[model samples]
Target: MPEKKQKKRPGGMDLDQKAYQGIRQMLFFNEILPGQKIKYQDLADKIGVSITPVIHALKRLEFKNVVSHAPNRGYFVNETSLKEITEIYDTRLLLEVSLVPEIIRHLDAESMDRLGKAFDAYREAVKEENYYNRLMTDMRFHLTIASMAQCQIQLKILQELFDTLLLKYTRNLILLGIMDSSLDEHVHIVKSLTDRDMDGLRQALSTHLDHVRNHITDGFRKMFAVKPRQMVDLFSLQ
Candidate 1:
């Protein structure tokens, strides 16, 4: 006898997921902006959904530390700070470098092919001047290596960390006119991985990440110095 297929819930769960993704994108691209309080109705209206799904989405984001809720006030985008940036990159470096050996040991022809394809796509995106697409492709390249490491916990953390920092940091690097050099660093890391030289891979990865950290720190300094009022207005955004 054939097994019966269970019916899936229509609209409700799907709407919630859609709302979550919509709100997440807004947060990622600074559409909502950091430290801005988000209203449920406004989000629902923007997402073309009802308040229920929006609330559900906000709850999920809150759980992920992407958003925060208050007793009386509504949801606010999690503010990014230099201290948080430092901690995130520090943790990323520790976990990512630790995974290098495992990734190299387990890397296969198929994994190499995937990495090569992602890197090529990234290079093309960079040439096209599509910064967002280039950033995503670059992320795909690193996450592909992380996938090869087979550490689910570490992979999850890395993904979250990148999600929080990738856009802001990439934009800063692009503004600094060093995005091309960063791409070259990526090329070196890929070369090391392909050669199965763990030491080279570690050094390349460390150099790339350290550059990112320094750029982010410098960017933040310049941003705050130029727009000091923006920092003070964070809590006032509604």
Candidate 2:
């Protein structure tokens, strides 16, 4: 029906792309905070959709380890342990840095064209008022380059890291009012990749990851500093 077709997907997206956009936006903005209790029906209402689509979206998010279902408690955002986050970034630095050569070697005219378009979309997202769109566009641009390289295993690693680290960094960036910087980093990474500057790519990726790691680390410290100090007396007994 025309009415069904016209229905906006959760997160202000068209019905066809609604589910994808909804999850992508949610992850990108860290809208679903870590350890926050979530109910499917409630999330559905918040997004202005139904429980069916939300369930579908949550299933997809589970693959990325972004959300988990607990018996009796329903669904909730996954908490990222500091140690786990460190391990994720370590693997990311190793896997993605190794991807530079493969991507450069397989680089072709058409692939570069597609990369350019994705990068442009990221730029447009930055200019737009929609934070959700900016996040989705940013992911599209990076994933496009990764796909062009055609490395399945590496793609999996990047995908995992993207889900794990995105919220941590996204939340920090938002708190710092530097959401635009996230978009800028995507453009910088794409530029390095487009130029076939392996060294540039290496440096870009390193800086990008380092910035993310620092952001999360700093955020954790800021958020939990007082709570950790509260444990000092308990640790003193040991």
Candidate 3:
């Protein structure tokens, strides 16, 4: 008698999250370079899955405008354009600043202390030159505060912005690379929150957003100086 063949087990991810994870992983690791052509079947093969999952993933990316389909040209990875990044940062600043009052009302002494610990970890990650670790911890600190606001919709929006920025930030930029003072900014934000200083929170958030915008602009300029085509200004094209 022939031996019975074992059935292949399904992947651990649910369909939607699996698609999200696949796209996110590709974007984060720089596997899918900007301006690269995207073929659904090819992507399916590359990811070692089927065309169904790949198409689903591409649709999600398209909704995010991370991928675009040109007539008869299949799909293409959207470049991290100047206008898109600026808009993302601006929207994020507005959302975060508006949440300051709500956050102040919700945070207690213990939550503030927890945020402090997260900031400490971020500082250590920066000192050790663990770039990704520092980036994640900084996100953690912000999300902790965002959570205190008790707004689920805002939390979801914030996560999307954070993911988009993290994907784009992997590229080299002088302002960000040279001045890693994110921890300092976090300290100020936490202090304002602790003291229930709404004005201070507003100021701190504004300063932080300005710093981020400057860094992004400076980094892209530097990157473009090295390679002219690496930078994209989407609004200029429009």
Per model, state how many residue pairs clash.
Answer: 0, 0, 1
Error of 3 at 77 (Å): 0.6
Would you list the C-alpha lDDT of every candidate in the order shown? 0.77, 0.69, 0.73
- Candidate 3 lDDT, tens digit per residue, 152-220? 899899999887776655543212444557768877887788788989989998898789777877666
Pick by lDDT: 2 or 3, better one:
3
User: Model 1, poorest ten-residue lDDT window?
Assistant: 167-176
Model 1 error, position 214 (Å): 1.0
Cα-lDDT of candidate 1: 0.77
Error of 3 at 188 (Å): 1.6
The worst-scoring run of ten residues by lDDT in candidate 2 lies at: 171-180
Model 2, span 21-106: residue lDDT tens: 56667766556677877676766766666777777777777776778888887778887566776677677667777788888888
Off by over 4 Å in 1: 1-13, 166-178, 228-238
Candidate 3 C-alpha RMSD relative to the actual structure: 6.5
Candidate 1's TM-score reads: 0.84
Task: Check candidate 3 and list the clashing pairs.
Answer: 173-219
Q: Which stretches in model 2 have alpha-carbon errors above 4 Å? A: 1-33, 36-64, 68-76, 164-173, 176-191, 226-238
Model 3 bad stretches (over 4 Å): 1-12, 172-178, 228-238
